[model samples]
Target: MINVRSREFAVPFLQRLIQVDTCNPPGNEHKLSVLLQDVLRETGIASSIKSVEQGRSNLEAVITGPGSRKLMFCGHLDTVSPWTTAAGRYPPHGAVIEGNRMYGRGTSDMKSGLAAMLLAAASLHQDGIRLAGDLIFLATAGEEVDSCGARLYADQSSLAVLDGIVIGEPTGSRVAVGHKGALWLRISLFGRSAHGSMPQLGLNAVEGMMEVISLLHRHALEWQEHDPVLGSSSLSVNKITGGVQTNVVPDHCTIDVDIRTVPPLQHGPLRREIEARLQEIQQLHPDYRYQVEQLLDRGVVYTDPAQRLITTALEIAARQGGAGDAILQVQGVPYYTDGSVLHDNGRLPVLIYGPGDHRLAHQPDEWVDIDDYLASIDFYRELAIRFLGTAEE
Candidate 1:
């Protein structure tokens, strides 16, 4: 059994954690996971590290209270790539306190939220607070990449049994109940290779691929359906590669696409639709040869407005912040996160509320307001108290 500590002890520990650099892309997260295990142990929060991929790991800890109802707090331990700016990676350069602000990478994109969860668990455990349910803390890895951590955790038999989940992604104090989903596709086209000088001799795969892109652009008009919360689905042709030399009319071209979907739209049908559209184009231009394959698929997420978990979080935020109707419903986010994976597959009521500006997440001057970090911890702690009730020893 691990022994827990007070809030004061937890805070400095979190700061020291923020002091560690665990940036992804060759995400060196094991060392940090070990550090977290040490910190969590200090508060009697026993934890275990699980991994599907070597080096990338997820950490889980639990504080048993006095109830059958279970409440889970989850945040990613792996951070996005650091800024290519002056701050650099080592020492995380500017993690200084300029009066009220705390400047550093992962500080906002959210080491702050991660810190809050740790402190909350320690504080609640040390106080011997009684609860309505067991409290689970999950710090996952590879969230900034594919949702490998969330997917692995959710697939666990134990995680599937949880009653509810709260994902600490920066929502700036509002109770965010939903997020859009993402599908990554790669479209490849084939054509006869010909010398650049003889333009018409060989088929131009680049043009054939562009034709498909044009069709996709036209198809976007038909796909522009919207929902009350997640708005319209979006398509972005982010990357295209073909042709080896400036002079040659390349025989192959491939395009990478990103598709964002709202809740009502599932991936199976959407994928079929895309394939159908491509097939239609193929029929129209029999000479064209192409194939479409999924690179990544993530489902959309939205809790019913009346869900008990969401309502509880809103009420807690409202009472503590004096903002009654503090439910935040948002549309498409440019990128994807594990929140959607947890909500869509785990089928657990999930919300993302934390501290920091989304824009500064990976920026050079990335930082979080110290007050915001502390306040978010307070809010989450109150939420734990409410959901877990008063911990009964």
Candidate 2:
């Protein structure tokens, strides 16, 4: 097995990334982009930062060569809100290392992967390792919210020619070929307001919404579409709001349902099914009307298993981690990422591989095993070597 302990700069770079506090809701990725841009500058690599929204920016750096084949590395800069662990052992921004683990907000959710990509690419640039294709590094903003940075990049015509892309999402050193998408919908229920004392006089919107929720669950269970690797899709009512006062019957209710969908499933049919279910609820209650709105519909993304990127990642994982540690396999997680944007819009193939456990994402005192972190530095470094051949090789 290859020893990565000597890669002294990777952990410190990740520590600096975690300390920047690019917490979403007000994701100030522009600040971090400036810092990253400075690092690229010191490597003598040209880069550009484009603003996605106020205080949010996307950084793109290209290491161009004489070849037309292009490969890109992507990592999200925004992170979820800070949290305290159940044991109350560490602060979110502490970036503390105990034994072989580092705990902090965004530490696992993905500053570490971002750091690995940045450092690997920077090292390549500093060493002047020429390749057969252009090497593009993209640090995206608003990945935790809307993937605005990815959408921005997808709009550019220049990137349509990319041969492959690797998203540095926390994958625990595994290579993920695909993941489920999210169809977040908000449904509104309406009813006649009446005094709570005389409930029979008016319909209750909350009760109507409850019925709709039940119907949603029933349909979700009956839906036969399931991915072999991703398993069956799922629906859950994550949020519900209604009722202004206890004395008066509520006239309105709003509930948000999150549906995790597998790729190859058309989102149109699901949306239509939801509408039909809502219509059924409305028809049963003549006095009540229902409304539905799509809050978000991020599509599922999958790179074909036959793609060179997948084969190469598996090969690299095997070579770097040896037989026991590198358990690289084709798998899917129940989450949406900027890869959805690239796959759906730009028609690009994206592979997800990195350190850190996905279970720790958004958790209090989130942490990554230092060994995994160091292992990923080797992963990214070797991946670059395999994708973009070195001069001596």
Per model, state how many residue pairs clash: 12, 0
lDDT tens digits, residues 1-393, model 1?
Answer: 233233355445556767777788766677678898987786667899997577878888887766788888888887776666556543453466666777777887778888887777777777667666888888888788777788898788465567788877776766776777888899998888888999889889998887889988887778776877666888889999999898998999999998888856778988899899888887887777888989998777777758788778777766766753433333233345677767546478777778887777777767777777877777778888877687443
**What C-alpha lDDT do the candidate models reach, one value each?**
0.76, 0.82
Q: What are the per-residue Cα lDDT tens digits for candidate 2 across 1-393?
A: 112234566677677788898999789999899989987787688899998888989999988877778888999999998874564589787789898999998888898888888877777766567876788899999999888898898897466688888988998788888888788888898898999999999889988887888888898877747898676788889999999898999999999888988756667898898898777767777788878889888877877777888888989887876767637667876677888888746377778888889999988778999888877876786787787675555
- Reference-based TM-score of each model: 0.89, 0.94
Model 1 regions more than 4 Å off: 1-15, 86-94, 324-335, 344-346
Residue pairs in clash, model 2: none
lDDT of 2 at 132: 64
